[model samples]
Target: MDHAPQLIQERSAPPATLVIFGASGDLTRRKLLPAVDNLARHGRLPDQFALVGVARTPMSDEQFAESALGGKSLLDKRQLAGGVRYVAGGYDDPETYKRLAETLDELDAVRGTSGNRLFYLSTPAGAFEPVINGLAGAGLNQATETSFARLVIEKPYGRDLATARELDGVVHGAFEEHQVFRIDHYLGKDTVQNVLALRFANSIFQPIWDRSWIDHVQITVAETLGVGTRGGFYEGAGAMRDIVQNHVLQVLALALMEPPVSFEGENLRNEKVKLLQAIRLPTDRDVSEAAVRGQYTRGGTREELMAGYREEVGVDPLSRTETYAAMRLNVDNWRWAGVPFYVRTGKRLPARLTEVALQFQRPPHLPIPADQLTELDADALILRIQPNEGISLRFGAKVPGHSFRVRTASMNFSYDQTFVEESPEAYERLLLDALIGDASLFIRSDEVQQSWRIVDPIIEHWERDRSPIPSYEAASWGPTDADRLIGRNGRKWRNAS
Candidate 1:
């Protein structure tokens, strides 16, 4: 096994034309184009880079460019205007793809791109297959030895294991495993990458990273707002499919994956795949014991009333969809055999934060008197992923007094305070990685299936049971059962505040 890590080169990708399938969509305007602009501003974009927008709506290249980057400075607008071109056509039409292929070829000739291409499927999930098949039918899936072609598929890969596998099969028909990039923007966060750096780059933590010293790991991705205008989409996704399956699980893999021999794309991804496969998948009975699901109810004063999940604009009156979910998972492996991994995510919570906290076991012998230990907490290391980006270590310390009264004190390191430069947004880093052919931050097909495999049974159990879904208040952490899920194990969930 190769374990030698390789240094990533800080170089721009060769000239390529990035084709976004849903160019007229909200994501294109809000995230995609802005990310590209940021990369260009940083001098990271290839000199001959180009963008081709494809969508059903008919618009001229100038109109599409304006819609995507309209508010930019004069210089940026001029530079973007020349590289951006639009092709208006339906996703299912073969002729549309033919025109798209011709457009790419023309861009290659005019822009000196040398036929390199990246196809980004920003369209709805339903359009994924048709778009993939359309590209394969148009002979755009394969690249010559000197050139390359890659595809970036956005999330909600499938509803469940079977569907995920089917989607994988469909994707493979057009692009090889190496040619596909399954993007999860969470993996691009500076704090997330910091997890790997903090682990593998340091000697102090690795020796205690496994079962002997660590008691449990908690991963939380919380949101304080309701579904809002996305209630229709939320009805089908909920917290499990939306947050847990993709985002939370991926974070878990990062926290738990063994150090790879190399940071090469395949080597790093292999360890993550192993971590997911080693998850002690929950049985039907295990689901009832280890998992808790809930939806948020109304809260706040009359003038500031909030709506419940069912009361959301597009939700069903009696929807069983879970807006909040918590689970206790165990990984059956040598390094983490007895350790538990607790993950929870929800909307309308007390705050919007994403974090991972590792609670270490108490010392074998507490020299302090039992009375003096009342105020002390177990040693903890927290990796804060959002809102405030930082790492904090909590340890017991003596209160300033004659008596040895103990209380926890935090030693903190914050990205904002410690660094002079602002970290780029997640989308910006992910887009640049895709452009440069770095698959390290993206999920692979097998990793997706493995995650779904762990959650599918729990989803099934939740569906079969007729019991009413639990509820929490709009601004609370989650359902009380989530407390019990960990409390039963003589532990408790960490507070985001």
Candidate 2:
């Protein structure tokens, strides 16, 4: 059997018109445009392709194309003359939608492009409903005999379960289930997909990837930047809603999911939703003991100094937002029962990183020295999701020139060293996936509701109590309580790079 790691399989590109709702927004210019450019550069787009950028501001197609493709690298830029256009309209403005609908025809006439359109809801959450209604009103959401129409929504699906359900109603009213792409970019990451490959592609891991051999799992996404320019947005959406609700939860589900019947896209997503559903809600006692919410205060480490969240632009001075959250979660099923899954995510910490650590159970038969137990920590399977995308395994190894002293050493599988190519960014991957009608990376409607159900109670508890969220230093892991929450279990977060 070949023990080689595999890359995400590339498939045929579909010819479709791409539309961006918030064309002037940062996400559109920074991610959407660049991703499209990359797709074009890779020769993945069809000759009949077109892009329609819709926003509240009116700008010429040349102006909009220049704005969208302005700072993109040369490798990402491609020739798309007469293949892109801009349609200015408010999210709730019916007239704007009509104009955009008309522009689709104009693009088709000029480029012989099909009527196929993928509408990316690049606008903020508040505008989601209005845009959906606007599409419906403008008759742009209909699937004609000649073409397909798809709607792609950005993350932060909702503030809670109720809002999510409400948003679901608004979106479902305008488009069918398959046409609505609820994208969670994390799923598009080459490394995230590799999690499946690392387990299934290798025979060494599957048999031992259970509660019997695995001690605990930790998924962390730490960011060094504070609220910054997104203070207004971050204030309303703390770390929990902003990151954990979708990104962290998706990562957790992927980590905990059982091996799917097949490695196909939808099959993987079906398994993911099941794993997510298996997560037991935090009880009152669990919340009191296992959950931690923290805010970053004014302090500095030896390396760098930083301001508190309140000091950021657009943030309320008396902001009650949480920059850090740590919780002990569990899957009530037999596979993960009794094994605590510790998940922590934060902003304005020591670094910007994302990783999933699977700590395997200690050896049932220990022949090593008793004093070396700390060094004999569980065999660890570490998958770095960002900074460096790779997999590392840690196991007990004999110390150099020593008696029987054993230490853990990492055997790594670095993607860059092996593949020698940059993994396409998440947006590019997801965009290409959407164009090909792959709904695997996007969230299923039910999955969105289930995530909200799990998080709804925590939000309710925080709202009712108005408790004082603990503060941590700018360049520290998090509050002291967050450490203790894990320490009491006799386990600590591994020192990660």
Best of the candidates, TM-score = 1
Q: In candidate 1, how many clashes are counted?
A: 3
The alpha-carbon deviation from the true structure for residue 234 of candidate 1, after best TM-score superposition, in angstroms, is: 1.0
lDDT of 1 at 284: 91
Provide the overall lDDT of each model, using Cα atoms, as 2-decimal numbers.
0.91, 0.84
Candidate 1 pairs with clashing backbones: 2-261, 3-261, 4-261
How do the residues 1-497 of candidate 1 rate in per-residue lDDT, one tens digit apiece?
88989998666666899899999898888888888888777777877888899999999988987876786542456555577889999899999999998888888888888899999999999999999999999999998998989999999899999999999999999899989999999998999999999999999999999999999999999998899989999999889999999999999999999999988999999999999999998889789888999999998568888888889999999899999999999999999999989999999988889999999999999877889888788999999998789999999888999987999899999999999987888898988888889999999999999999999999999989999899998888889999999999799989866
lDDT of 2 by residue, 312-403 (tens): 89988887888899888889887889889888999878878899999988777887669865676678899999878898899988888757
TM-score of every prediction relative to native: 0.97, 0.94
Q: Over all chains combined, what TM-score does candidate 2 have?
A: 0.94
